[model samples]
Target: MNRTLYDLAGADPALRFSPFCWRTRMALAHKDLPVETIPWRFTEKERIAFSGQGLVPVLVDGERVLHDSWAIAEYLEETYPHCPSLFGGPEAQAVTRFVNAWTDAVLHPWVGRLVVRDILDVIRPEDRGYFRESREKRFGVTLEAFVAERETVLPEFRRALQPVRLVLRAQPFLAGEAPAYADYIVFGAFMWARGASAFRLLESDDPVHAWRERMLDLFDGLARRSPGHEV
Candidate 1:
């Protein structure tokens, strides 16, 4: 198909998982666009080099080439205005940016510390060295050292989710009655952890967990059907 997405995969090609990629996937689904996702591994940077940087979630919509999940989401919204709205309006779009930034800056990193080690075990063997080298450089610490105290710090990570819990307590979604780009932005991080590790990030009774269940059930169980941990 002309619409293609280079999605990050584990040793099993079916195991697609990357918070950023998941955002694009959900955006495409939100826009009712069909996409052919190509499984990509860490060391396979050359495969997506045409995008001008190393990353998955690269969108090739016919001749238009795009990278970055947020950019892709905007493109989809603008390109397919006839489709269901991903962002409700300009104000919502602007607000969604805050959600996107918080996710990329705060939630992603926190979840990474919890699941980064598990990722190494699932990635292809050949990609392990590259993953370790790159991650260590970015984190400035060995993976083992970085995640050594994950259990001890679990409470702190959950506490960081208070903002989301607060929102869900009042509305069914971060964007209000229905899911929107903002919801997808936050859910991507959870999908990342769910895909990589079986660790329980949210308590079963937590409002966040209830919201996650609602998200997973969206688009007829699209995220839930993906190969990943039940969490």
Candidate 2:
């Protein structure tokens, strides 16, 4: 394939579940780009060694290789100007960067606290030791201990989502009327949770939940068709 993406996956190869990868996937769909995605596992770092990194969401387009999801999105926007824009304009791109940073720093950690333990069950058997050790070292605690109070902390996660909720309450999408990179940035976290855990992260009446439903319905149920919980 001319355009290929190494997407993080679970034991089931069809389960492409990385939040970062989801960002890239949504960005690609937004740009009206076609890509062949290869399912990748955590322990398979060497598989993506060509990108000079261990992370998935590696994109190889023709001779150019890109690793970071944000970089890949930018590349797509610049390369395919004729296609739909991921960010509306320079101003939109600047604001979307803040959304990206927030998703990485605040939202991801909250989602991780809720679903990190459950991730072990979906990952490949060989990747289990590496995942647990790496995650434990990063968090300085065992997986079970890390997510032990997921139920109690669910409220905190929901509380942290107030910013997005507030924005959604006013606008249909983070980038105004139409979805953009900002929407993908936040929705990626929800996709991560949906793919790995059965946890209900939002309430039915929540505006955030409504936004997520619209996101899942995008690209003709691209995300909803994935193997994940209804919530």
Candidate 3:
């Protein structure tokens, strides 16, 4: 245990990662804060109940349990005041919120749907049945039926990304010079889509692509001893 709030949340390393948590984890890494990761299953309401919510990425500091991703990010900033700005300045807040909303409110649902078909669709027949059954249990549907059914979420997802893609075309990071909590929160969802399955729509030269590569560099650039693990 790191003897912090982070440890109480994620005791298992492999299970500790979720994109939402990953964003903050990456941010903490960016700021060089020592954090412990807690992994919880989507179906495991006990974990949620423990934290008084049904979400992963809960941060457990010495005595505080921070739930929401953004709030946690802010807490880290305030707690570790020595680091440079993460949310950025006056106008930066708007841009930061914009990027976060675009990903969570828009791109994620679509990406989730696409991955089920594109990535989980590739699961072996027996495993596919189990995976789909599990998904349907959490999301709704039977394995045999879900694949046979068409996802209505597709069109809406593409429509949502339109503006987001437009924004990415203007700058590599949503916050401009470098990534902020805003870039990470949004990128967290995109990372899910990218890792789970391929995004055909992403190939169009949006700053989002550059941002992903940039994150990899940032993850690799620093030493683990200075802050947290690199990536």
Give the Cα lDDT of each candidate: 0.92, 0.92, 0.58
Candidate 1, 27-141: lDDT as tens digits: 9988889999999998888999999999888999999999998889888888899999999877788888999999989999999999898899889999999999999999999
Q: Per-residue lDDT for 1-231 in model 3, tens only?
A: 252333211122232324576677777877877665544444455755767886656777777777777777778777767786677654765567666776676666666666555445333344455456667897676533544433554555556666655766776666666777776777676555544444343544545555666765676642121222222
Scored against the true structure, residue 219 in model 2 reaches a CA lDDT of 96
Candidate 1, position 106, lDDT: 92
Candidate 2 at residue 109, lDDT? Answer: 95
Candidate 2 per-residue C-alpha lDDT over 111-189 given as tens digits, one digit per residue, 9 for 90 to 100: 9999989999999899999999999999999999999999999898899999998999899999899998899989999
**Cα RMSDs, all models:** 0.9, 0.8, 6.0
After superposition, the stretches of candidate 3 with alpha carbons farther than 4 Å from their true spots are 1-17, 117-159, 198-201, 204-206, 221-231
Give each model a TM-score: 0.98, 0.98, 0.69
Question: RMSD in Å for candidate 2, one decimal?
Answer: 0.8
Q: Local error of candidate 2 at 86, Å?
A: 0.7
Write down the lDDT that model 1 would get.
Answer: 0.92
